[model samples]
Target: MPLLAGFATSLSLIIAIGAQNAFVLRQGLRREHVLPVVLTCAVSDAVLISGGIAGLGALLTSSPLALSIAKYGGAAFLFTYAVIAARRAVRPGAMSPADHAPAALRSVVLTCLGFTYLNPHVYLDTVVLLGALANQRGTDGRWIYGLGAVAASFAWFFALGFLARKLGPLFARPRAWQFLDAGIALVMTTLAAWMVLPAH
Candidate 1:
Protein backbone atom coordinates (compact mmCIF):
# COMPACT_ATOMS: atom_id res chain seq x y z
CA MET A 1 0.00 0.00 0.00
CA PRO A 2 2.82 2.37 0.88
CA LEU A 3 4.60 1.53 -2.35
CA LEU A 4 1.51 2.13 -4.43
CA ALA A 5 0.78 5.31 -2.56
CA GLY A 6 4.25 6.61 -3.23
CA PHE A 7 4.10 5.71 -6.88
CA ALA A 8 0.73 7.38 -7.30
CA THR A 9 1.76 10.49 -5.45
CA SER A 10 5.04 10.84 -7.32
CA LEU A 11 3.37 10.27 -10.66
CA SER A 12 0.73 12.86 -9.88
CA LEU A 13 3.41 15.42 -9.21
CA ILE A 14 5.74 14.53 -12.07
CA ILE A 15 3.21 14.05 -14.83
CA ALA A 16 2.49 17.76 -14.85
CA ILE A 17 3.70 19.76 -17.86
CA GLY A 18 6.91 21.58 -17.00
CA ALA A 19 10.20 22.82 -18.41
CA GLN A 20 11.91 19.48 -17.97
CA ASN A 21 9.13 17.63 -19.72
CA ALA A 22 9.11 20.16 -22.52
CA PHE A 23 12.84 19.75 -23.08
CA VAL A 24 12.61 15.99 -23.01
CA LEU A 25 9.72 15.99 -25.47
CA ARG A 26 11.59 18.24 -27.84
CA GLN A 27 14.70 16.08 -27.71
CA GLY A 28 12.64 12.97 -28.25
CA LEU A 29 10.88 14.49 -31.22
CA ARG A 30 14.19 15.54 -32.74
CA ARG A 31 15.58 12.08 -32.07
CA GLU A 32 18.60 13.73 -30.50
CA HIS A 33 20.22 12.55 -27.27
CA VAL A 34 16.99 10.98 -26.07
CA LEU A 35 18.57 8.22 -24.02
CA PRO A 36 20.89 10.51 -22.16
CA VAL A 37 18.16 13.01 -21.48
CA VAL A 38 15.78 10.43 -20.05
CA LEU A 39 18.52 8.76 -18.07
CA THR A 40 19.63 12.04 -16.61
CA CYS A 41 16.11 12.84 -15.52
CA ALA A 42 15.49 9.41 -14.02
CA VAL A 43 18.79 9.27 -12.17
CA SER A 44 18.42 12.77 -10.86
CA ASP A 45 15.00 11.89 -9.51
CA ALA A 46 16.39 8.79 -7.84
CA VAL A 47 19.08 10.81 -6.10
CA LEU A 48 16.62 13.46 -5.00
CA ILE A 49 14.12 10.89 -3.72
CA SER A 50 16.87 9.11 -1.82
CA GLY A 51 18.00 12.36 -0.31
CA GLY A 52 14.46 13.07 0.75
CA ILE A 53 14.19 9.66 2.36
CA ALA A 54 17.43 10.43 4.18
CA GLY A 55 15.91 13.49 5.79
CA LEU A 56 17.57 16.12 3.56
CA GLY A 57 14.13 17.55 2.95
CA ALA A 58 14.04 19.09 6.38
CA LEU A 59 17.40 20.71 5.82
CA LEU A 60 16.27 22.09 2.48
CA THR A 61 12.99 23.52 3.75
CA SER A 62 14.71 25.30 6.62
CA SER A 63 17.26 27.00 4.35
CA PRO A 64 15.58 30.13 3.01
CA LEU A 65 18.83 31.37 1.47
CA ALA A 66 19.25 28.20 -0.53
CA LEU A 67 15.70 28.36 -1.78
CA SER A 68 16.16 32.01 -2.74
CA ILE A 69 19.28 31.27 -4.74
CA ALA A 70 17.55 28.40 -6.54
CA LYS A 71 14.52 30.53 -7.30
CA TYR A 72 16.50 33.34 -8.94
CA GLY A 73 18.90 31.06 -10.77
CA GLY A 74 16.10 28.85 -12.06
CA ALA A 75 14.08 31.84 -13.22
CA ALA A 76 17.06 33.19 -15.14
CA PHE A 77 17.77 29.88 -16.82
CA LEU A 78 14.14 29.34 -17.73
CA PHE A 79 13.89 32.83 -19.17
CA THR A 80 16.96 32.28 -21.32
CA TYR A 81 15.60 29.00 -22.62
CA ALA A 82 12.25 30.64 -23.26
CA VAL A 83 13.97 33.21 -25.45
CA ILE A 84 15.70 30.49 -27.43
CA ALA A 85 12.43 28.64 -27.91
CA ALA A 86 10.71 31.84 -28.95
CA ARG A 87 13.38 32.47 -31.56
CA ARG A 88 12.91 28.99 -32.93
CA ALA A 89 9.17 29.54 -33.13
CA VAL A 90 9.62 32.78 -35.05
CA ARG A 91 12.16 31.27 -37.46
CA PRO A 92 11.05 27.72 -37.88
CA GLY A 93 13.21 25.76 -40.32
CA ALA A 94 13.53 22.07 -39.70
CA MET A 95 10.31 20.36 -40.67
CA SER A 96 11.44 16.85 -39.87
CA PRO A 97 13.86 15.09 -37.55
CA ALA A 98 16.17 14.31 -40.46
CA ASP A 99 16.63 18.00 -41.16
CA HIS A 100 17.62 18.84 -37.58
CA ALA A 101 21.26 18.81 -36.54
CA PRO A 102 22.01 16.71 -33.51
CA ALA A 103 22.99 18.71 -30.47
CA ALA A 104 26.18 17.89 -28.53
CA LEU A 105 25.78 15.19 -25.90
CA ARG A 106 27.51 17.30 -23.27
CA SER A 107 25.37 20.35 -23.94
CA VAL A 108 22.19 18.32 -23.83
CA VAL A 109 23.24 16.62 -20.62
CA LEU A 110 24.11 19.93 -19.00
CA THR A 111 20.76 21.38 -19.99
CA CYS A 112 19.01 18.34 -18.60
CA LEU A 113 20.87 18.80 -15.34
CA GLY A 114 19.86 22.43 -15.21
CA PHE A 115 16.25 21.54 -15.81
CA THR A 116 16.39 18.97 -13.06
CA TYR A 117 18.34 20.82 -10.40
CA LEU A 118 17.83 24.53 -10.94
CA ASN A 119 14.06 24.48 -10.47
CA PRO A 120 13.11 25.23 -6.88
CA HIS A 121 9.85 23.38 -7.41
CA VAL A 122 11.79 20.18 -8.04
CA TYR A 123 13.28 20.45 -4.57
CA LEU A 124 9.97 21.29 -2.97
CA ASP A 125 8.16 18.46 -4.74
CA THR A 126 10.72 15.68 -4.56
CA VAL A 127 12.72 16.56 -1.47
CA VAL A 128 10.37 18.33 0.90
CA LEU A 129 6.86 17.20 0.02
CA LEU A 130 7.66 13.67 -1.04
CA GLY A 131 10.07 13.28 1.85
CA ALA A 132 7.56 14.30 4.43
CA LEU A 133 5.03 11.93 2.93
CA ALA A 134 7.38 8.97 2.71
CA ASN A 135 8.63 9.43 6.25
CA GLN A 136 5.10 9.10 7.44
CA ARG A 137 5.30 5.46 6.54
CA GLY A 138 7.13 3.49 9.24
CA THR A 139 10.94 3.18 9.03
CA ASP A 140 11.07 0.24 6.61
CA GLY A 141 7.96 1.35 4.80
CA ARG A 142 9.56 4.72 4.07
CA TRP A 143 12.34 3.13 2.05
CA ILE A 144 9.85 0.95 0.24
CA TYR A 145 7.78 3.98 -0.57
CA GLY A 146 10.83 5.81 -1.88
CA LEU A 147 11.66 2.89 -4.13
CA GLY A 148 8.21 3.10 -5.60
CA ALA A 149 8.60 6.82 -6.24
CA VAL A 150 11.94 6.26 -7.91
CA ALA A 151 10.41 3.55 -10.05
CA ALA A 152 7.67 5.90 -11.14
CA SER A 153 10.21 8.56 -12.11
CA PHE A 154 12.21 6.14 -14.22
CA ALA A 155 9.10 4.72 -15.85
CA TRP A 156 7.63 8.11 -16.70
CA PHE A 157 10.80 9.55 -18.18
CA PHE A 158 11.53 6.47 -20.24
CA ALA A 159 8.00 6.36 -21.57
CA LEU A 160 7.91 10.04 -22.40
CA GLY A 161 11.31 10.10 -24.07
CA PHE A 162 10.77 6.94 -26.05
CA LEU A 163 7.12 7.07 -26.93
CA ALA A 164 7.39 10.61 -28.27
CA ARG A 165 8.76 9.21 -31.51
CA LYS A 166 5.33 7.87 -32.29
CA LEU A 167 4.15 11.40 -32.96
CA GLY A 168 6.72 11.94 -35.71
CA PRO A 169 4.07 12.23 -38.41
CA LEU A 170 2.20 14.96 -36.60
CA PHE A 171 5.34 17.03 -36.06
CA ALA A 172 6.60 16.52 -39.60
CA ARG A 173 5.11 19.79 -40.71
CA PRO A 174 6.94 23.09 -40.18
CA ARG A 175 3.79 24.64 -38.81
CA ALA A 176 3.54 21.93 -36.18
CA TRP A 177 7.09 22.55 -35.07
CA GLN A 178 6.45 26.27 -34.95
CA PHE A 179 3.38 25.80 -32.81
CA LEU A 180 5.21 23.41 -30.51
CA ASP A 181 8.13 25.76 -30.00
CA ALA A 182 5.78 28.66 -29.39
CA GLY A 183 3.95 26.67 -26.73
CA ILE A 184 7.20 25.69 -25.08
CA ALA A 185 8.32 29.30 -25.02
CA LEU A 186 5.06 30.37 -23.42
CA VAL A 187 5.23 27.66 -20.77
CA MET A 188 8.85 28.38 -19.89
CA THR A 189 8.27 32.10 -19.63
CA THR A 190 5.22 31.65 -17.43
CA LEU A 191 7.07 29.29 -15.10
CA ALA A 192 10.00 31.67 -14.80
CA ALA A 193 7.68 34.55 -13.99
CA TRP A 194 5.87 32.49 -11.39
CA MET A 195 9.14 31.60 -9.69
CA VAL A 196 10.25 35.23 -9.43
CA LEU A 197 6.95 36.76 -8.55
CA PRO A 198 5.81 36.97 -4.95
CA ALA A 199 3.09 34.61 -3.77
CA HIS A 200 -0.38 36.05 -3.13
Candidate 2:
Protein backbone atom coordinates (compact mmCIF):
# COMPACT_ATOMS: atom_id res chain seq x y z
CA MET A 1 0.00 0.00 0.00
CA PRO A 2 2.79 2.40 0.86
CA LEU A 3 4.60 1.63 -2.35
CA LEU A 4 1.46 2.17 -4.33
CA ALA A 5 0.77 5.43 -2.58
CA GLY A 6 4.30 6.59 -3.18
CA PHE A 7 4.05 5.70 -6.86
CA ALA A 8 0.84 7.59 -7.22
CA THR A 9 2.26 10.64 -5.53
CA SER A 10 5.36 10.60 -7.64
CA LEU A 11 3.36 10.28 -10.82
CA SER A 12 1.18 13.18 -9.83
CA LEU A 13 4.19 15.36 -9.16
CA ILE A 14 5.85 14.58 -12.48
CA ILE A 15 2.77 14.71 -14.66
CA ALA A 16 2.51 18.46 -14.50
CA ILE A 17 3.92 20.19 -17.61
CA GLY A 18 6.97 22.21 -16.68
CA ALA A 19 10.19 23.73 -17.97
CA GLN A 20 11.92 20.49 -18.85
CA ASN A 21 8.94 19.04 -20.63
CA ALA A 22 8.37 22.34 -22.40
CA PHE A 23 11.88 22.33 -23.86
CA VAL A 24 11.58 18.71 -24.95
CA LEU A 25 8.26 19.27 -26.65
CA ARG A 26 9.52 22.41 -28.37
CA GLN A 27 12.61 20.67 -29.73
CA GLY A 28 10.70 17.59 -30.68
CA LEU A 29 8.15 19.61 -32.59
CA ARG A 30 10.92 21.43 -34.38
CA ARG A 31 12.43 18.00 -35.12
CA GLU A 32 15.81 19.57 -34.85
CA HIS A 33 17.57 17.51 -32.19
CA VAL A 34 15.61 14.47 -31.13
CA LEU A 35 17.92 11.82 -29.74
CA PRO A 36 20.42 14.09 -28.05
CA VAL A 37 17.71 16.18 -26.39
CA VAL A 38 15.86 13.10 -25.24
CA LEU A 39 19.00 11.45 -23.95
CA THR A 40 20.24 14.55 -22.10
CA CYS A 41 16.90 15.06 -20.37
CA ALA A 42 16.76 11.43 -19.32
CA VAL A 43 20.34 11.41 -18.07
CA SER A 44 20.00 14.66 -16.12
CA ASP A 45 16.80 13.50 -14.48
CA ALA A 46 18.45 10.21 -13.61
CA VAL A 47 21.30 11.95 -11.85
CA LEU A 48 19.14 14.48 -9.95
CA ILE A 49 16.58 11.86 -8.99
CA SER A 50 19.37 9.66 -7.75
CA GLY A 51 20.87 12.47 -5.72
CA GLY A 52 17.48 13.28 -4.18
CA ILE A 53 16.98 9.68 -3.21
CA ALA A 54 20.43 9.68 -1.66
CA GLY A 55 19.35 12.48 0.72
CA LEU A 56 21.63 15.23 -0.56
CA GLY A 57 18.56 17.44 -0.56
CA ALA A 58 18.95 17.79 3.15
CA LEU A 59 21.84 20.14 2.80
CA LEU A 60 19.93 22.25 0.32
CA THR A 61 17.00 22.59 2.68
CA SER A 62 19.08 23.01 5.80
CA SER A 63 19.60 26.68 5.10
CA PRO A 64 16.51 28.83 4.87
CA LEU A 65 18.37 31.68 3.21
CA ALA A 66 19.75 29.34 0.58
CA LEU A 67 16.29 28.00 -0.19
CA SER A 68 14.99 31.54 -0.68
CA ILE A 69 17.85 32.29 -2.98
CA ALA A 70 17.10 29.21 -5.01
CA LYS A 71 13.42 30.10 -5.32
CA TYR A 72 14.11 33.68 -6.40
CA GLY A 73 16.76 32.49 -8.82
CA GLY A 74 14.39 29.96 -10.29
CA ALA A 75 11.69 32.56 -10.64
CA ALA A 76 14.04 34.84 -12.50
CA PHE A 77 15.14 32.13 -14.88
CA LEU A 78 11.58 31.14 -15.66
CA PHE A 79 10.59 34.72 -16.31
CA THR A 80 13.56 35.23 -18.62
CA TYR A 81 12.74 32.03 -20.45
CA ALA A 82 9.19 33.20 -20.78
CA VAL A 83 10.40 36.34 -22.56
CA ILE A 84 12.65 34.36 -24.87
CA ALA A 85 9.87 31.96 -25.74
CA ALA A 86 7.53 34.82 -26.47
CA ARG A 87 10.13 36.41 -28.71
CA ARG A 88 10.55 33.16 -30.60
CA ALA A 89 6.82 32.97 -31.06
CA VAL A 90 6.61 36.51 -32.37
CA ARG A 91 9.72 35.91 -34.46
CA PRO A 92 10.19 32.26 -35.20
CA GLY A 93 13.71 31.05 -35.83
CA ALA A 94 14.75 29.11 -38.90
CA MET A 95 17.66 26.88 -39.68
CA SER A 96 20.42 28.18 -41.92
CA PRO A 97 19.50 28.39 -45.62
CA ALA A 98 22.12 25.74 -46.35
CA ASP A 99 21.67 23.67 -43.19
CA HIS A 100 18.60 21.47 -42.83
CA ALA A 101 18.21 22.11 -39.12
CA PRO A 102 20.13 23.59 -36.22
CA ALA A 103 22.85 21.06 -35.50
CA ALA A 104 20.58 18.51 -33.88
CA LEU A 105 23.11 16.99 -31.51
CA ARG A 106 24.42 20.29 -30.24
CA SER A 107 20.98 21.85 -29.96
CA VAL A 108 19.73 18.95 -27.94
CA VAL A 109 22.75 19.02 -25.69
CA LEU A 110 22.36 22.72 -24.99
CA THR A 111 18.60 22.54 -24.46
CA CYS A 112 19.04 19.69 -22.04
CA LEU A 113 21.70 21.62 -20.20
CA GLY A 114 19.39 24.63 -19.87
CA PHE A 115 16.56 22.47 -18.61
CA THR A 116 18.74 20.74 -16.08
CA TYR A 117 21.08 23.46 -14.88
CA LEU A 118 19.98 26.96 -15.91
CA ASN A 119 16.39 26.47 -14.92
CA PRO A 120 16.58 26.83 -11.15
CA HIS A 121 13.12 25.29 -10.89
CA VAL A 122 14.58 21.94 -11.86
CA TYR A 123 16.88 21.87 -8.87
CA LEU A 124 14.32 23.13 -6.37
CA ASP A 125 11.53 20.80 -7.36
CA THR A 126 13.40 17.68 -8.42
CA VAL A 127 16.26 17.75 -5.95
CA VAL A 128 15.20 19.56 -2.78
CA LEU A 129 11.45 19.02 -2.69
CA LEU A 130 11.45 15.51 -4.12
CA GLY A 131 14.23 14.49 -1.76
CA ALA A 132 12.32 15.90 1.17
CA LEU A 133 9.21 14.05 0.08
CA ALA A 134 11.11 10.79 -0.27
CA ASN A 135 12.52 11.10 3.21
CA GLN A 136 9.02 11.40 4.64
CA ARG A 137 8.36 7.82 3.66
CA GLY A 138 11.07 6.70 6.06
CA THR A 139 13.97 4.42 5.26
CA ASP A 140 11.82 1.44 4.35
CA GLY A 141 9.69 3.16 1.74
CA ARG A 142 12.26 5.72 0.60
CA TRP A 143 13.74 3.57 -2.10
CA ILE A 144 10.34 2.68 -3.50
CA TYR A 145 9.32 6.31 -3.56
CA GLY A 146 12.50 7.21 -5.35
CA LEU A 147 11.95 4.42 -7.84
CA GLY A 148 8.50 5.72 -8.62
CA ALA A 149 9.81 9.23 -9.23
CA VAL A 150 12.50 7.91 -11.54
CA ALA A 151 9.93 5.91 -13.45
CA ALA A 152 7.74 8.95 -13.85
CA SER A 153 10.56 10.99 -15.34
CA PHE A 154 11.56 8.27 -17.77
CA ALA A 155 8.05 7.45 -18.90
CA TRP A 156 7.00 11.05 -19.42
CA PHE A 157 10.11 12.12 -21.33
CA PHE A 158 10.05 9.19 -23.74
CA ALA A 159 6.33 9.42 -24.38
CA LEU A 160 6.26 13.19 -24.87
CA GLY A 161 9.33 13.27 -27.12
CA PHE A 162 7.94 10.43 -29.23
CA LEU A 163 4.56 12.05 -29.67
CA ALA A 164 5.93 15.52 -30.27
CA ARG A 165 8.08 14.29 -33.13
CA LYS A 166 5.08 12.64 -34.76
CA LEU A 167 3.25 15.94 -34.56
CA GLY A 168 6.13 17.96 -35.96
CA PRO A 169 4.72 18.16 -39.45
CA LEU A 170 1.45 19.49 -38.19
CA PHE A 171 3.31 22.21 -36.35
CA ALA A 172 4.98 23.23 -39.58
CA ARG A 173 2.21 25.72 -40.10
CA PRO A 174 3.10 29.28 -39.09
CA ARG A 175 0.11 29.63 -36.78
CA ALA A 176 0.97 26.41 -35.01
CA TRP A 177 4.39 27.73 -34.12
CA GLN A 178 2.81 30.86 -32.76
CA PHE A 179 0.45 28.88 -30.59
CA LEU A 180 3.24 26.69 -29.23
CA ASP A 181 5.41 29.67 -28.44
CA ALA A 182 2.53 31.41 -26.72
CA GLY A 183 1.81 28.33 -24.68
CA ILE A 184 5.43 28.12 -23.64
CA ALA A 185 5.42 31.71 -22.51
CA LEU A 186 2.23 31.24 -20.56
CA VAL A 187 3.44 28.16 -18.75
CA MET A 188 6.73 29.76 -17.83
CA THR A 189 5.10 32.93 -16.53
CA THR A 190 2.61 31.02 -14.42
CA LEU A 191 5.28 28.78 -12.98
CA ALA A 192 7.49 31.72 -12.22
CA ALA A 193 4.70 33.40 -10.30
CA TRP A 194 3.90 30.23 -8.43
CA MET A 195 7.48 29.80 -7.36
CA VAL A 196 7.52 33.21 -5.73
CA LEU A 197 4.22 32.85 -3.97
CA PRO A 198 4.27 33.43 -0.23
CA ALA A 199 3.59 29.85 0.76
CA HIS A 200 5.75 28.49 -1.99
Candidate 3:
Protein backbone atom coordinates (compact mmCIF):
# COMPACT_ATOMS: atom_id res chain seq x y z
CA MET A 1 0.00 0.00 0.00
CA PRO A 2 2.84 2.35 0.86
CA LEU A 3 4.62 1.59 -2.39
CA LEU A 4 1.41 2.08 -4.25
CA ALA A 5 1.04 5.40 -2.54
CA GLY A 6 4.59 6.31 -3.48
CA PHE A 7 3.92 5.42 -7.10
CA ALA A 8 0.79 7.50 -7.13
CA THR A 9 2.75 10.39 -5.72
CA SER A 10 5.35 10.02 -8.43
CA LEU A 11 2.75 10.01 -11.16
CA SER A 12 1.16 13.14 -9.76
CA LEU A 13 4.50 14.94 -9.70
CA ILE A 14 5.33 14.23 -13.36
CA ILE A 15 2.07 13.85 -15.25
CA ALA A 16 1.62 17.49 -16.17
CA ILE A 17 2.11 19.89 -19.05
CA GLY A 18 5.76 20.77 -18.68
CA ALA A 19 8.72 21.40 -20.98
CA GLN A 20 9.95 17.82 -20.91
CA ASN A 21 6.57 16.27 -21.72
CA ALA A 22 5.84 18.90 -24.35
CA PHE A 23 9.10 18.26 -26.18
CA VAL A 24 8.59 14.51 -26.10
CA LEU A 25 5.03 14.67 -27.43
CA ARG A 26 5.99 17.10 -30.21
CA GLN A 27 8.96 15.05 -31.36
CA GLY A 28 6.93 11.89 -31.26
CA LEU A 29 4.33 13.44 -33.53
CA ARG A 30 6.88 14.93 -35.92
CA ARG A 31 8.73 11.60 -36.04
CA GLU A 32 11.77 13.57 -35.11
CA HIS A 33 14.88 12.31 -33.28
CA VAL A 34 12.58 9.97 -31.40
CA LEU A 35 14.84 7.33 -29.94
CA PRO A 36 17.33 9.90 -28.69
CA VAL A 37 14.64 12.28 -27.55
CA VAL A 38 12.71 9.72 -25.58
CA LEU A 39 15.89 8.30 -24.15
CA THR A 40 17.00 11.74 -23.04
CA CYS A 41 13.68 12.45 -21.40
CA ALA A 42 13.49 9.08 -19.68
CA VAL A 43 17.10 8.93 -18.57
CA SER A 44 17.23 12.46 -17.26
CA ASP A 45 14.03 11.79 -15.38
CA ALA A 46 15.46 8.62 -13.88
CA VAL A 47 18.65 10.33 -12.74
CA LEU A 48 16.81 13.22 -11.16
CA ILE A 49 14.32 10.95 -9.49
CA SER A 50 17.08 8.74 -8.16
CA GLY A 51 18.92 11.75 -6.87
CA GLY A 52 15.73 13.04 -5.32
CA ILE A 53 15.36 9.83 -3.36
CA ALA A 54 18.98 10.23 -2.38
CA GLY A 55 18.19 13.70 -1.05
CA LEU A 56 20.48 15.69 -3.36
CA GLY A 57 17.80 17.64 -5.20
CA ALA A 58 16.88 19.63 -2.11
CA LEU A 59 20.27 21.30 -2.13
CA LEU A 60 19.48 23.06 -5.40
CA THR A 61 16.39 24.75 -4.03
CA SER A 62 18.35 25.95 -1.02
CA SER A 63 20.80 27.88 -3.16
CA PRO A 64 19.07 30.98 -4.48
CA LEU A 65 21.91 31.95 -6.83
CA ALA A 66 21.96 28.51 -8.45
CA LEU A 67 18.19 28.46 -8.65
CA SER A 68 18.10 31.86 -10.37
CA ILE A 69 20.73 30.85 -12.88
CA ALA A 70 18.81 27.72 -13.85
CA LYS A 71 15.55 29.64 -14.20
CA TYR A 72 17.08 32.25 -16.52
CA GLY A 73 18.93 29.70 -18.58
CA GLY A 74 15.77 27.65 -19.11
CA ALA A 75 13.81 30.78 -20.01
CA ALA A 76 16.43 31.79 -22.58
CA PHE A 77 16.47 28.38 -24.18
CA LEU A 78 12.68 28.25 -24.39
CA PHE A 79 12.49 31.72 -25.96
CA THR A 80 15.03 30.82 -28.63
CA TYR A 81 13.23 27.57 -29.37
CA ALA A 82 9.96 29.49 -29.58
CA VAL A 83 11.39 31.84 -32.23
CA ILE A 84 12.47 28.90 -34.37
CA ALA A 85 9.04 27.34 -34.04
CA ALA A 86 7.32 30.61 -34.95
CA ARG A 87 9.47 30.85 -38.08
CA ARG A 88 8.37 27.41 -39.19
CA ALA A 89 4.76 28.38 -38.59
CA VAL A 90 4.93 31.52 -40.71
CA ARG A 91 6.83 29.91 -43.59
CA PRO A 92 4.38 27.38 -44.90
CA GLY A 93 5.70 24.76 -47.32
CA ALA A 94 9.23 26.08 -46.95
CA MET A 95 10.20 22.52 -46.14
CA SER A 96 9.38 19.30 -47.89
CA PRO A 97 10.47 15.71 -47.33
CA ALA A 98 13.43 16.22 -49.65
CA ASP A 99 14.41 19.44 -47.93
CA HIS A 100 14.11 18.02 -44.47
CA ALA A 101 17.31 17.14 -42.70
CA PRO A 102 17.50 14.51 -40.01
CA ALA A 103 16.18 15.81 -36.70
CA ALA A 104 18.73 17.04 -34.18
CA LEU A 105 19.15 13.84 -32.22
CA ARG A 106 22.32 14.85 -30.38
CA SER A 107 20.90 18.25 -29.62
CA VAL A 108 17.74 16.69 -28.23
CA VAL A 109 19.89 14.68 -25.87
CA LEU A 110 21.58 17.83 -24.59
CA THR A 111 18.36 19.81 -24.47
CA CYS A 112 16.59 17.19 -22.41
CA LEU A 113 19.59 17.05 -20.11
CA GLY A 114 19.29 20.75 -19.49
CA PHE A 115 15.52 20.75 -19.25
CA THR A 116 15.54 18.04 -16.60
CA TYR A 117 18.64 19.00 -14.68
CA LEU A 118 18.59 22.80 -14.89
CA ASN A 119 15.04 23.35 -13.79
CA PRO A 120 14.83 24.39 -10.17
CA HIS A 121 11.30 23.09 -10.01
CA VAL A 122 12.52 19.66 -11.06
CA TYR A 123 14.97 19.54 -8.20
CA LEU A 124 12.51 20.94 -5.75
CA ASP A 125 9.61 18.73 -6.76
CA THR A 126 11.38 15.51 -7.71
CA VAL A 127 14.70 14.99 -6.06
CA VAL A 128 15.11 16.83 -2.81
CA LEU A 129 11.45 17.12 -2.01
CA LEU A 130 9.79 14.02 -3.43
CA GLY A 131 12.64 11.76 -2.41
CA ALA A 132 12.51 12.96 1.15
CA LEU A 133 8.78 12.55 1.27
CA ALA A 134 8.79 9.11 -0.31
CA ASN A 135 11.17 7.88 2.34
CA GLN A 136 8.78 8.75 5.10
CA ARG A 137 7.13 5.37 4.73
CA GLY A 138 10.17 3.45 6.08
CA THR A 139 13.42 2.10 4.60
CA ASP A 140 11.70 -0.74 2.82
CA GLY A 141 8.94 1.52 1.69
CA ARG A 142 11.52 3.95 0.34
CA TRP A 143 12.74 1.28 -2.05
CA ILE A 144 9.20 0.73 -3.27
CA TYR A 145 8.72 4.45 -3.57
CA GLY A 146 11.85 4.77 -5.67
CA LEU A 147 10.68 2.02 -7.97
CA GLY A 148 7.34 3.73 -8.32
CA ALA A 149 9.02 6.99 -9.27
CA VAL A 150 11.14 5.25 -11.89
CA ALA A 151 8.08 3.53 -13.23
CA ALA A 152 6.35 6.88 -13.64
CA SER A 153 9.19 8.08 -15.84
CA PHE A 154 9.01 5.04 -18.09
CA ALA A 155 5.23 5.02 -18.38
CA TRP A 156 5.02 8.71 -19.22
CA PHE A 157 7.66 8.55 -21.97
CA PHE A 158 6.19 5.57 -23.77
CA ALA A 159 2.59 6.70 -23.40
CA LEU A 160 3.30 10.25 -24.55
CA GLY A 161 5.34 9.11 -27.55
CA PHE A 162 2.69 6.58 -28.48
CA LEU A 163 0.00 9.23 -28.52
CA ALA A 164 2.14 11.51 -30.65
CA ARG A 165 2.83 8.78 -33.20
CA LYS A 166 -0.89 8.12 -33.46
CA LEU A 167 -1.43 11.78 -34.35
CA GLY A 168 1.07 11.78 -37.22
CA PRO A 169 -1.53 10.89 -39.82
CA LEU A 170 -3.84 13.70 -38.80
CA PHE A 171 -1.11 16.29 -39.19
CA ALA A 172 0.11 15.48 -42.71
CA ARG A 173 -1.17 18.62 -44.37
CA PRO A 174 1.03 21.71 -44.75
CA ARG A 175 -1.52 23.79 -42.89
CA ALA A 176 -1.49 21.28 -40.09
CA TRP A 177 2.27 21.58 -39.83
CA GLN A 178 1.96 25.33 -39.58
CA PHE A 179 -0.59 24.98 -36.84
CA LEU A 180 1.66 22.64 -34.90
CA ASP A 181 4.62 24.97 -35.26
CA ALA A 182 2.59 27.92 -34.09
CA GLY A 183 1.26 26.01 -31.14
CA ILE A 184 4.74 24.99 -30.13
CA ALA A 185 5.88 28.58 -30.28
CA LEU A 186 3.03 29.76 -28.14
CA VAL A 187 3.52 27.08 -25.51
CA MET A 188 7.27 27.61 -25.29
CA THR A 189 6.98 31.38 -25.11
CA THR A 190 4.28 31.28 -22.47
CA LEU A 191 6.27 28.88 -20.32
CA ALA A 192 9.37 31.02 -20.74
CA ALA A 193 7.52 34.10 -19.68
CA TRP A 194 6.28 32.29 -16.60
CA MET A 195 9.80 31.28 -15.71
CA VAL A 196 11.14 34.81 -16.05
CA LEU A 197 8.44 36.43 -14.01
CA PRO A 198 9.44 37.70 -10.59
CA ALA A 199 7.70 36.00 -7.68
CA HIS A 200 4.91 38.03 -6.12
- Top candidate, metric lDDT: 1
Candidate 1 lDDT over residue span 1-200, tens digit each: 99999999999999999999999999998889999999999999999999998999999988999999999999999999999999889977754566767878999999999999999999999999889899999899999999889999999999999999999999988889999999999999999999999999
Question: Candidate 3: deviation at residue 45, Å?
Answer: 1.2
After TM-score superposition, the amount by which residue 185's alpha carbon in candidate 3 deviates from its true location, in angstroms, is 1.3
After superposition on all C-alphas, the RMSD of every candidate to the true structure, in Å, is 0.9, 3.3, 2.0
Give the Cα error of residue 134 in candidate 3, in Å: 1.0
Per residue, candidate 2 scores C-alpha lDDT tens digits across 11-99 of: 67666788878888877776666667777876786688668878777776778887687678878878888998798678654321122
Stretches of model 1 off by over 4 angstroms after superposition: none
- Local accuracy by lDDT, each model: 0.93, 0.73, 0.76
Q: What would the TM-score be for candidate 1 when compared with the true structure?
A: 0.98
Ordered list by TM-score, greatest first: 1, 3, 2
Best by TM-score: 1
How would you encode candidate 3's per-residue C-alpha lDDT over 1-200 as one tens digit per residue?
A: 76567668877888887777777777787677777777777777678777777767667667889888888988888888889889988987943333477667677678777767656667777787678887686777876788777787778787887678787677766777788778888988888898899769
